[model samples]
Target chain A: MTPILIALTIGIPWLGAIIVWLMGDRREDLTHWVSILFSIGAAITSVLLLPNASQETALTIPIGGDFGDFTFVADGLGIFLSVIAAVIGSLAVIFSKSYMKGEGSLGRYYAFVLFFIGAMVGLVLSSNLLLIFLFWEITALCSYALISFHNDDPKAVKGGIKALIITSIGGVGLMVGALIVYAYTGSYDINNFLANYSTIPGNILALLAFGFLIAAAAKSAQFPFQTWLPDAMEAPSPISALIHAATMVNAGVYLLARFYPAFKDVPYWSEAVMIVGALSALLAAVMALVSNDLKRVLAYSTVSQLGYMVYAIGTGSVYASQFHLFSHSIFKALLFLSAGAVIHSIGTRNMLEMGGVGKKHPLVKWVFIIGALALAGLPILNGFWSKELILESGLKNGPLWLYIVMVFVAGLTALYTIRCVWLVFFGEPRSDYHAHAIGWEMIAALLPLAGAALVSWLAAGRFSVLLGEKSLPFHAIEPLPYKEMMHEILSLPTLVVMAVITAAILLWVFRKKLEGLINGLKSIRWAAENSFGFEAINNAIVKVTQSTAEALRVTQTGILNWNVFGILASVILLLAILVLGA
Target chain B: MNLPIPLVVLITILCLAGIGLYCLLITRNLIKVVIALQLIVKGAVLAFILAGNMTGQLNLAQSMALTVIVADTIVAVVGLALAVQIRLKTGSLDIKSLSSLKR
Candidate 1:
């Protein structure tokens, strides 16, 4: 029965992809309905598996031979991530019905989206490392294809290629780690490797540990790889909500948390993960503070939120990280979709072009504010609880200095969230842009997420029980009861942070008198806008690859015989080497 | 172990393959390239037959050789047709002049 549920969760969306793709762009209405129905079906199936979440393996299919067994585990971690992917994926699809109403190539859009959701589900549920890698690449492919869905635009095409190349570098890290595990254990089973990884030598284990760190950093858009995600805003708004905000980026944090127990004791590994997360959170928050583009701000915020999760894992708190992942997924998806609603209506993504939009679209205004309040870690919202938990874990288990830096980053997060809300909704109209009315489809999607942002933290006890205490063995902190946790979160330091946020907002409101002081910070703003030259370095790497490819193009003379000659020569050379070696 | 017949046949096939490769690399006319490709196929066929005879699988080799012949003939016919089309379109059959297709 568990296996059947897993199959339905993965297979239904894939089947929907094929069916909608065949329906073609001419039948846009049918394609939209079919995609929504199938995605919701997957969502329901994943929810049905929640009660069965445990340490035991749910199902296995023996492929025989060297490939090893394909297994699926309904463990707490796997089932939780699958539920996030399926549920948020369904909401994104429903929002797209109105968001992508008149867009051509509707079939292609729906197909790539459905395929991506299925791949994400398969990725989380699979217990085999090789099978996980396969699904990982599939998600990357779907992201690339969907990012470039508007292929007529050169920027969209460039964004897609950049995303593909950067993420593929991470893919190599994961592949190498998988191969090393296979070499040492003679199997691709993740549970088998995790149970016996210590028997492998120390140096190889270190290599695997750091290799996976690089993989997670690259995939999650931490540090140097963080630049591509902001550019990924060239994709449509719904795709941004679905892939960039809700699911794909979270996979990296998921990978780190999943392997934390095995790699925690590797010397300096935890500290390095902490530094990466801390730096990403700080840098992205700074960048978000300066961005004028609406979606780009959310994109940077997603990177920062993911950094917090990674930092939680680094602090030896898997429960903190996974719980944060849960809260962040709901609120971020809500924020992005609300931003989508605004963008869809105003026909622009520039915040400077939008002002007092709240007065025009009151529903969108309120929903965006709910998401912002949650994002700012205000009291009683979901982000506040999970974030305070991460801070508590960090202080207790990790370095003191890094925990302080993260708290400062949380303030920065609040500052940006307030700035974003004020710029878009509070000030007088800044540009002459007529806004469209919010549709029922968009409203239906945003309401549930807004509700979740307010109440999902109430499930903290259940989340802890689901993710058993033994999940993090090395630095396992005792789970706090809900009432006590809430009391601690509303203490003195929380009041101080809230007060600081309010003061910052008031200062921004009266900034006309502080023009001189604002001018003094021009250099910092310039650095923030440039992403501190990280984008330049990433661009250089891409340029080098393109030039190298261009130089190699000379080998293809386009004469058929030349190509055949090249192939035959290579074949002969390989044969001679084999014969000589034998 | 001194199997002279098989050894000589193997050497002959290798020589044919070498000559065909040389023509493929150095030839200027498109038609000569097609003939060189056929030479390579013929060498492979001869080697298969020799291996089959030595290993007592003559009937299998013969059937494989017949299939190869049919495939090679079809390829040759298509290659000639494409070459003729190129000649008519561009008024030249020199392989070097086909650099127009290069980026």
Candidate 2:
């Protein structure tokens, strides 16, 4: 039963991708419905596997080589992420049906989206590093294709290429780490590595530990690699909701938590992770505060939220990290989909052009508010409970200074969230832009996520049990019940919440004064707007690669004889070197 | 049977490969380039046959040589066709003029 469930979770979306691709854009309606059905099927299978989350290696195929066994574990961590991928993926597909209505190349859009779902599920479930890397690359390819789904737009195409190149660099990190492990253990099985990682020499183990950290940071858009994700907003909003917000970005923190036991002892490793997370959270929050583009703001917030999870892992709180990941996946998806509805209606992503939109589209307005409240960590929402847990764990187990910085970041999160809500939904009409009526399909897609954001923290007790009792190296004490969790969160002097509220109210009341202050800090705003010169650095790297390729093009010659001469000379040189070595 | 056949074959293979590569690098005419390419293929075939003979796999070497000949013939035919097309289009077979195909 478990094997079949795992197969269905992965295989359904894959099969759906092919079927939807064949259906083509001529029957866009059919293609959309097929994608939704397949995504839901995958989601259902993942839910079915939840009860069996205690089972390790629920299914295995003996591939019989250095590749090791192809295995899937229905463990708590894997199953939890799989469910998020599939369920949120289904909602995104449903939302896309409306958001992408009458769009060209519907077949291609749905195909890549469904394929990404399967790849993400496979990525989380696989217990073999080789298979994980394969699935990882597949997700990257899917993201590239989907981000450039608007292929006619030059910006979209450039964004897609940048995403592919940067993520592939990270993929190389993961591949190198996997190969190093295989070199030492002669197996690619993750279970094998996890069980006896310390038996490997300390220096080599440290190298592997940092290599995996690089991979996670790159994948999750932590720090220096984060500029790619905000640019990835060029993708359709539904794709943003599904891949960037809910599933794919979480893979980085998931990687850290999944391998925490092996890497926890590596000197300065946890500190490095904490620093990466803290910097990303703070920087992305400031970027979010300054950005006028709605989706870009949300994209930056997603990075900030992911940083908290990474910070949780760094603080030796895998359960806190995973729990926050759950809450974030729910609310962020809701926010993105609601933002999608708004963008689809107004046909622009700029928040300055979007005032009084809530008056026109009340349903979207309310749902967006719900998402914002959850994101800002207001009490009684899932984000509040999970975020408090992360901060609590950080304070208790990690550095006090880092914990203090994260709390300040929480205030920044609230300031940006409310600012986003006000500029888009509440302010005086800043422009004459008209909004389309909120569609039922978009509202339907948002409803479940909103409910989850409101009530999902009730599952904290069960989740704690699953993490503590079943998964090794993740022995979180059983979490407090919902009532006690709320009391605990409310009883922490409420300093962060108070700061957030005060900052939000002051920003709202003194808009003119703050505008002057914001203008006074022109240099800081300029730096934030340009992602603090990281974009320039990345662009220089790209330019160098292009120029190097141009230099190499001198050898192409277009003359057949010269080309053959080049190949023959290289072959002869290699042979000579081999002979000399022998 | 006791002659230095292996050494003689090795020297011949080296000379053929060197000559082939020199022609390829120095040739101006597309047809001469094609001939040079074939000469390199012939050297490779000779080396394969010599190695197989030394290992007592004469039959296998002969069969491989035959396969190489067939493949080379097909390649030569296609190359000449492409050369013809290039000549007809450009009114010259000078390899330098063919550089127009470069992006």
On residues A1-582, what C-alpha lDDT tens digit does candidate 2 reach at each position?
Answer: 888999999999999999999999877778788888998998899899888876468889898856778998878888889999999999899888888888998988998998999999999999899999999999999999999999999999999988898888889999999999999988888878888887899999999999988899888999879988998999999999999999998988988998898899999999999999999999999999999999999999999999999999999989889999999999999999999999999989999988988888887888889999889998788898899888888888888899888988988898899899999999788888877776677888999988888999889988887777766543444655667666666765466656765776577668776787777889988999999899999989989998999999887778766677678789989999999999
Across A225-271, the per-residue lDDT of candidate 1 in tens digits comes to 89889988989888888899889988888888888878988999999
* lDDT (Cα, 0-100) at A376 in candidate 2: 90
> What number of clashing residue pairs does each candidate have, in the order they appear?
0, 0
Q: Which stretches in model 1 have alpha-carbon errors above 4 Å?
A: A469-480, A487-503, A506-510, A552-582, B1-3, B51-74
Most TM-score-accurate candidate = 2
- Residue clash pairs of candidate 1: none
User: TM-score of candidate 1's chain B against its reference?
Assistant: 0.90
Best by DockQ: 2
- How far in Å is the alpha carbon of A570 misplaced in model 1? 6.6
Candidate models: Cα lDDT each = 0.88, 0.89
Model 1 scores a C-alpha lDDT of 0.88
